[model samples]
Target: MTDTTEPTALLTAIDLTARDARVRKRHRAELRFRGYGIFSIGVAVAALLWLFTSLAVGGAGAVYTTYIKIDVHLDQTVIDPDATGDAAVFAKASYQSLIRSGLRNHFPGVTGRRDQRALNGLVTLAAPYLLRDIVLDDPALIGTKTGIWILASDEADLIARGKGTKRSTKSRNDGQAAWIAELRSQDRVERRFNWQFFTGGDSREPELAGILVAMIGSVLSLLVCFAVAFPVGVLAAVYLQEFARRTWITTLFEVNINNLAAVPSIIFGLLGLYIFLNVLHLPRSAPLVGGLVLALMTLPTIIIASRAALQSVPESIRDGALAVGASRVQAIFHHVVPIALPGMMTGTILGMARALGETAPLLMIGMVAFIVDVPKSILDPATALPVQIFLWADSPERAFVDKTSAAILVLLGFMVLMNAGAVLIRNRFEVRL
Candidate 1:
C-alpha cells in the first residue's frame, strides 16, 4: 500500500510541473504580443509627427510676404487723363505706366527697353490694379507723391526671403539682384505678415492669391451637405432601427446600406454629374452641386454610424419606458434617441470632416473651375478648399509650392478642429449604461 501511494504522488507532482510550464509559455506569448502592439502604435505616431513637421516647415514661408517700398508720383495725367473725376476714369487708367516711370526714376542706370522690362518684372503684375483701387478709394491721392509698399513679384519675394537659388543667377544677370540689395540697404525691402493671403482671392500672381474664396465655398458646400444629410440620415436610421419589421426586405436594405458605405466616393460624384447636372441642369462648378454630391457620399456613412449608435442603447431602457405607460414611439424617441443623439452627431461631424477633405467628388462635378470671384451663395460658381489646394499643387510657379503646403496646413487644421469637436461631443454627452 505504501509503494502504491508514493507512485501516485510522484505522478501528481509531474502533472503539476507540466501545467506550470504551459502557463509560463502563455505569459511569454502575451508579453510578445503586447510589445508588438506598442511598437506598431509608436510607428504610427512617428509617421504622423514627420508629416506635420514637413508641412509646417515647407509652408512657413507663405505666412509672410515681401514688399518693395517705392515713392510713386501719382501722375494725374496717366491716372486721370480725362479729368472727368469719375471713378470709372481711375479704373480705366494705365497705372502700369506710372509704376514703370517710378521704377525708372528710382534707378537712373536702367535705360534700355530690355533692362526696363526686367526692372518692371520685379514688382507684382497686380501692382497697377492695386494702385487703381487705392486711387478710386481715396481720390485725394491722385496727384501727390507718397511712399507706398507694393507686393514684390514672386521671384523677388523668394530672393528677399533667401529662398531663390534657382532664380538667383538669372536675377543677377538681369541686375535685379543688385536692385534688391540696394533696396534692402535703403530699408525699402521688407517682409511682413501677408494679410492678403487670408483676405484676397485666387490670382495668377502668387503674392496676391488668398484662400478666402475657397474657404467661403467650402463653408457653403458644407452647410448644404449638413442640411441635406443630417435629417435624412437620422430619420432613416430611426425608421430602420425602431419601426421597420425584421424581414428579408429590411435585411436587403441593411446589406445594401453596408455595401454603399464602402463604395468609392468618385462613383457618387459621377452619379451627381448625371442626375444633378445633366438631367436637372444645375449650374456647373456651383457649390450647390458640389454639396449635393458630397451629401450623397456622406449619407451612407451617417446612416451606418447612426444605426450603430442606436443599437448600443440597452433594450431594458426601451422596455422600462414602455412599462411606465409610455407609447412605443415615445419610448424610442424621448429616452432612446436622446441617449443616442450624441453618438449620432459625432458620426455626422466625422462624416462632414471627411467630405470637407474630398477633392475627387467635387472635381467630377466641375468644382475645379478657376473661380476668381468670391461666391455670395451656394448657387454661385465656386471652388472649395480641397479643390483650391489641388489646383495650387498642380501649378508650375515655384512660389506655388509654398502656397500649396500652406493650403494643406489649413485643410488639416479644419479636419483637426472637426475631429476635436466630435470627441468633445462624445465625452460631454455620452450616456453610460
Candidate 2:
C-alpha cells in the first residue's frame, strides 16, 4: 500500500509541472504579440508624420509668387498701332514690345538683340497677356506709364524665392542673375500671396498656373457620382438584404460584389474606356464620364456596406414594426433603413473620397488633357485635381516641383475633409438601439 501511494503521488507531481510549463509558453507568446502590435503602430505613425512634414515643407514656397515691379509704359502706338480705339484692337496689339521696352529702360546698357532677348526672358511669357487685359479693362491706361507688378519668369521667381540653385545657366549667364539681384536691392522684386494660384487656370508658366479648374472638375464629378451611386446602391442593398429570396442568383451577386471590391482600380478605368467612351460615345475628359466610371467603382463598396448595416439591426425591430400593422416594405424602410442610414452615408462618403483621389481611371478616360479653361458645365472637357498633380509632377520645369507638391497638399486636404465628414456622420447619427 505505501509503494502504490508513492508512485501515484510522483505521477501527479509530474503532470502538474508539465501544465505549468505550457501556461508559461502561452503567456510569453501573448507578450510577443502585444509587442509586435505596438511596434507596427509606431512605425505607421512615424511614416505618416514624415509624409505630412515633407509635403508641407516642399509646398510652402508655392503659396507666394515672385513679382518684378516694372514701370510699364502702355504706349498706345505699340498697343493700338492703328489707334482704332477698340478694345479688341488693343487686345491684339504688340504688348510684348511694350514689356521689352520697359525692361530695357529699367536696366540700361542692355543693348544688342541677343542681350535684349535675354533681358526680356526675365519676365514670364504670360506677362504680355496680363498687360493686355489691364489695358482692355480700362483703355484709359493705354498711353500712360504706371508701375505694374509683372510676373517674373519661373527661373527668376525661383531665385527670388531663395531657390537659386535651380536657376538655369541661360538665365544666369545673360546677366539675369545680376539683374534680379539689382531688382531685389532696389525693392523692385518682391514676394506676395499668390491669389492667381487659386483664381486662375492651368498655364505653361508655373507662376500663372492655378488649381481652380481642377477643383471645379473634381466637384462636378463627385456630384454626378453621388447622384447616381447613392440611390442605386442603397436600393440594391435593401432588396438583397430585406426582400430577396435565399437563392443562387442572390448568392452569385454577393460573390460578384465582394470580388469587385478587390478588383484593381485600373480595371475600372479600362472598362470605362471601352463602354463609356467607345460604345456610348460619351465625351472624353468630361466630368460626366469621370463620374460614371467612379460610380461603377464605388457601387460595390456602398452596397456591401449598406447590406452589413441593415444586417446589424435587431430582428425584433422588424417584428415589432410588422406587428404594429406595417407592411413589409414599410417596416424595413421606416424602421430598419432609418437605423442603417448613417452607416450607409458613411460608407458612401468614404467611397467618394476614394473616387476623388483616383487618377488612372480619369486618365484612361482622357482627363489628363492639359485643360487651361475652367469647365462651366459637367459636359465640358476638364481635368481632375489628381490628374493635374500627375501632369505637374512629370513636368521638367524646376518650378513645377513646387506646384506639384502644392497640388498634392490640396488633394490631401480634400481627402482629409471627406474622411472627417464620414467620421462625424457616423458618430452624430448612429443608432445605439
* Model 1 CA lDDT for position 132: 84
Tens digits of per-residue lDDT for model 2, 1-433 = 9999999999999999998999999999999999999999999999999998888877876778888999989887787777789877887888888888889888888887877777897889988888888787888887899988888887778877666544466544437878888988888998888888888788888888898899999999999999999999999999999999999999999999999988888899999999999999999999999999999999999999999999999999999999999999999989999999999999999999999999988989998999989999999999999999999998878888888888999999999999999999999999889
The segments of candidate 1 whose C-alpha lies over 4 angstroms from its true place after superposition are 1-35, 80-89, 137-142, 165-174
| Lowest lDDT 10-residue stretch of candidate 2 | 165-174
lDDT of 1: 0.89
- Global lDDT of each candidate: 0.89, 0.89
In model 1, how many backbone clashes occur? 0
